[model samples]
Target: MEKIIIIGAGLVGSLQALYLAKKGHTVEVYERRNDIRKQKLVAGRSINLALSNRGWKALKRVGINTVVEKTAIPMYGRIIHDTEGNTTYQPYGLEKEAIYSVSRGGLNQLLIEEADKLENVSFFFEHRCLDIDVESNTIIFENDTREIEVKGDRIFATDGAFSAIRARLQKRDRFNYQQFYLPHGYKELTIPAGENGSFLIEKNALHIWPRGNYMLIALGNNDGSFTCTLFFPFEGEYSFESLKTEDEIDNFFKNVFPDAYELIPNLSKEYQENPTASLVTVRCEPWNYEDKVLLMGDASHAIVPFYGQGMNSGFEDCSIFDDILEDNNLDFNKAIPEFAKTRKKDADAISELALRNFIEMRDLVADESFLLRKKIEKKIFEKHPNKWMPLYSQVTFSHIPYSEALNNGLKQEKIMDKIMAKPNIESLWDSQEVEDEILSLSANA
Candidate 1:
């Protein structure tokens, strides 16, 4: 068995450990933070993540899906709130398909506990990775008291967006890397459970207040509370910077998200208390360094959370890497390079999709034309299931490669644009003429 060193015990790191340990490798996971399972998670930093099909497929492969599922609250659709305090419901898919909301810290803890149960898996918490020698297969890590060097046959860095390992690799010759930070920043707030622990809003759907420039989203938690995240520009007329005083915060929410403002009693306090965190998109190439080390998850392709696929994509990395290992007969030298080459395009595709979805989520979700497009797309997909799959479904519900999904989605967009341009398209969205046009366009394209 190989001696494998995995860095960063976050979602991807912990899950990767489980996969490697199951393959009979001796795995050591070094985390920079304290063991989350043993500590109280700081309030404002715990962003809830959406666990969709890609994430489930990974956990299911390791037989830990049930445990993770227990903590997830199924969000069937988006419950959109209008400025007038009105509401609209948009189902994510045709059937009862839903994305599960799981707390980031909670999921990480569960995965860590599961990994610990395996004799081959070991975890070292509070061990910050300082640097690495990729050619020598050596890593230097610093704890509270000392810096130590360790050697392993192979190393995997899942250390997240700001990976020290990736940083070190960037200093090397011919390593390609790019990082982009969105002007928008996010802050977490909460809507506590009501009397006797009941949800104040719709429990089974993701709630969104999509203003043109910014938005607020809430996902249900098992504790009968909802974790609400406000995504806004760091500076602007209606940005986080504009809301300085309690009264400004109050007035902003009351005018924009009055209903949510009422539900969150401590809105202003949480606004003041929570730190506004920046959103970054990371893209890099040659994720592996001569079989000595490989970058997985956010370390390789960190993306904005708009697609709700950051964790899902990371989890999928483990699954895809496992397939590469199997295909190459467990040869690291062959599998590592193949994994990087095969996965990079998909990573880039998802990164672009995530950015596009941010616009859909924050602006287009409320637009009448966008809603009409969605309805027409759903109708086309329902009639021609084999021929048409909505881009969202392709990304969220199926394991179709992200590159294919993006290509197909763009094609579908062009087709839909033509269909929507026909006279009286709104009234004829469900007409046979519309279906025939879509089918013909799809076939021709």
Candidate 2:
């Protein structure tokens, strides 16, 4: 068995540890944060993530599917709430396959509990990784309670976006790292429960208020409330910083998002007090240093949350690594390098798509042209079920490669524009014409 050391104890880190342990490797997880289950974490934040098929497949790979599904709240459609407080339902899938909303902390703790049960797995909390010796496969950890060093044949750094290990490695190698900051920023707000503990919005659908150029999104919590994320620009004439006072925040919401203001009792107070988080897309090459060290999750590629694929993509990484390892007969020398080469394109593609979807979510969702295109696309899906699934479905509900999904979506959008102009869906779908247009692109891709 290989000796593997994993850094970080977040969702991605925990998944890597469990997967390595299940492969009969002696796994040790070093986390900088205190044990979450033993700590008092704040509530009413980005408490949950949108869990989809990719994440489910990853959870199932390590035998945690049942446990995760138990905690999941299925959301089959998106409930769009306009400025007037009217609701419209947009189904994610025609069938029962739906994305799930589950508490992020709850899922992490569950993974930790499951990993603790395995005799080969060990967890070290508050043990921050200070440095890594890639040549020697050694890790140094430090905290007030303990100063420790561990050596393993291989190290997996699933540490998060601001990864210390990744920073250290970049200094040594010719790593190309770039972080693109979106003009948009996000803040968390709460929609508390009713007196009898009932959800104010429909508990089953992901709720969104798609304001032009900015938007507000919320997912249901099992606690009969919603945790909403308000996305807005960082700096402008009427940006977050411009609205310096609580009254300004109130007035902004009262004018643009009156429905949300009605639901959130402490709207102004929350807006003034809560932090405005930046949205960034991070990209790096070679995701690994030598044959001894590798990085996964946000440590490698951190995309924006607009697509709701951040966690799902990370989970899909775990699945991809597992497949490569099993295919190559568990040889890290062959597996790690080959995995990087294949996944780099896919990762880069999703980062771009995630950024592009920001436009779709905030602006295009309300656009007549985009809506007409979508209607055309849906008609095509109805006829060519096997060949053409909506780009969203392929990305969220299936195991399709991100690159393929993005490219297909781009081509479909071009065709959709033509179909939209015609006003008759049948004209675009004359068997020979539609097949010729789509198949030509598919064959080339």
Report the number of the highest-TM-score candidate. 1
Q: Residue 443 in candidate 2 has what lDDT? A: 48
| Local lDDT at 179 for model 1 | 94
Error of model 1, residue 157, in angstroms? 0.2
Q: Across residues 1-445, which tens digit of lDDT does each residue of candidate 2 receive?
A: 8989899999998888888888899999999988987855455564689999889999998888998887688999888878888877778876687899999888888888888889999999989999887888888899876768899988889999988888888887578888888888988899998778799879899888898888998898887888998888888876887887877888888888888889999887888788998988889887887678888999999999878888988989999999999999999998888888899899898898888888888877766667656665666676778877889988988888999988888877675555555655545555566556665655454
Clash list (residue pairs), candidate 1: none
- Cα RMSD for candidate 2? 2.4
Worst 10 residues of 1 by lDDT: 39-48
Measured over all alpha carbons after superposition, the RMSD of each candidate to the real structure, in angstroms, is 1.1, 2.4
Tens digit of per-residue lDDT, candidate 1, span 1-445: 9999999999999999999999999999999999989977653247788999999999999999999888788999999999999999999997779999888988999999999999999899999999998889999999998999999999999999999999999999899999999999999999988888788899999999999888999998877788999999999898888897999999989988989989988888889988989999999988989878999999999999999999999999999999999999999889888998899999999999999999999999999988999998888788778999999999999999999999999999999899878989879988888889899999998
Top-lDDT candidate index: 1
C-alpha lDDT (0 to 100) for residue 286 of candidate 1: 82
How many backbone overlaps does candidate 2 show? 0
Candidate 2 lDDT trough over 10 residues, lowest sum: 419-428
